[model samples]
Target: MPAIVHFEVRIDPERRDEAAKYLAETLAATRAWPGNQGIEALVDDADPCHILVVETWATTQDHDDYAAWRTTPEGKSSLGEILAAPPSKQVYSETLPLGL
Candidate 1:
């Protein structure tokens, strides 16, 4: 079954725009990664400095591999410096489905 991952990124208010731009630039490569189902970046309306990155993957292992890759030199280089704090990540599995 697929899994959902959420990354809560907090940036300095002054650098929010730059962070958003970096996210946009990096998303293409992320989406192209194997096992990635989808990815999205959303900025909080009440708190512009907070950006939420939602990602769906084929499995937990897939997400873990991608995360490990992101820490490598190549991945680190692609990510520009625009963060106030380290991103917080959480993983979830769909236990119950509500018909919409």
Candidate 2:
């Protein structure tokens, strides 16, 4: 089953809108990456500088591979430039809820 990745980041207050625009441009490569199902970025309603990225991949391993590549210079994303600090990430498995 596919895994869901929640990536949270806070952009530099100075970059603001520019950071959002930059992310839109940069995420194209991620959307096209192998095993990527889809990607969506959501800005916090209370804090425009904060962003939450929801991503779906064929499997946890797929996301892991992509994450490892992101650490390398070749596949590194320019996000660090606009980020105020390091991002947070967590992977989750889909689950069914029992009826009450």
Candidate 3:
């Protein structure tokens, strides 16, 4: 079954534009990574600096592997430069689409 992962982060208000560019450049690797189905980044309406990243993967294991890699020195991303607070994440599995 496919898995859905939500990654939410609060960006520095002064670096909103930079965050856009940074996420684009960084997430490109994720998009190309094995087992990645798709990914999207969205900004909050009430808070311009708040961003949510939605990612789809082939399975929970696939997402876990990708996430584990991000913690490594080689896979580390530069999110610290733009973030105002630590990021939060949620995982969902066993999806059942209802043709919405």
Q: What is the TM-score of each candidate against the true structure?
A: 0.85, 0.90, 0.91
Give lDDT: candidate 2, residue 45: 94
Put down candidate 1 lDDT per residue, 42-77, tens digits, no spaces.
889998888899999999888889889888887663
- Model 3 misplaced stretches (Cα beyond 4 Å): 95-100
Tens digits of per-residue lDDT for model 3, 1-100: 7999999999998998899789998899899889999999998999989999999999999999999999999999997889999999999997578999
TM-score of 3: 0.91
Which lDDT value does model 1 have at 56? 96
lDDT of 1: 0.83
Candidate 2: residue 26 lDDT (0-100) = 70
Clashing pairs in 2: none
Quote the positional error of residue 47 for candidate 2 in Å.
Answer: 0.8
Q: For residues 10-98, what per-residue lDDT tens digits would candidate 2 score against the true structure?
A: 99999886886778877887798899999999989999999999999999999989889888888878878899999999999777888
| Root-mean-square deviation (CA) per prediction | 2.3, 1.5, 2.2
RMSD (Cα, Å) of model 3: 2.2
Clashing pairs in 1: none
Error of 2 at 53 (Å): 0.5
Clashing residue pairs in candidate 3 are none
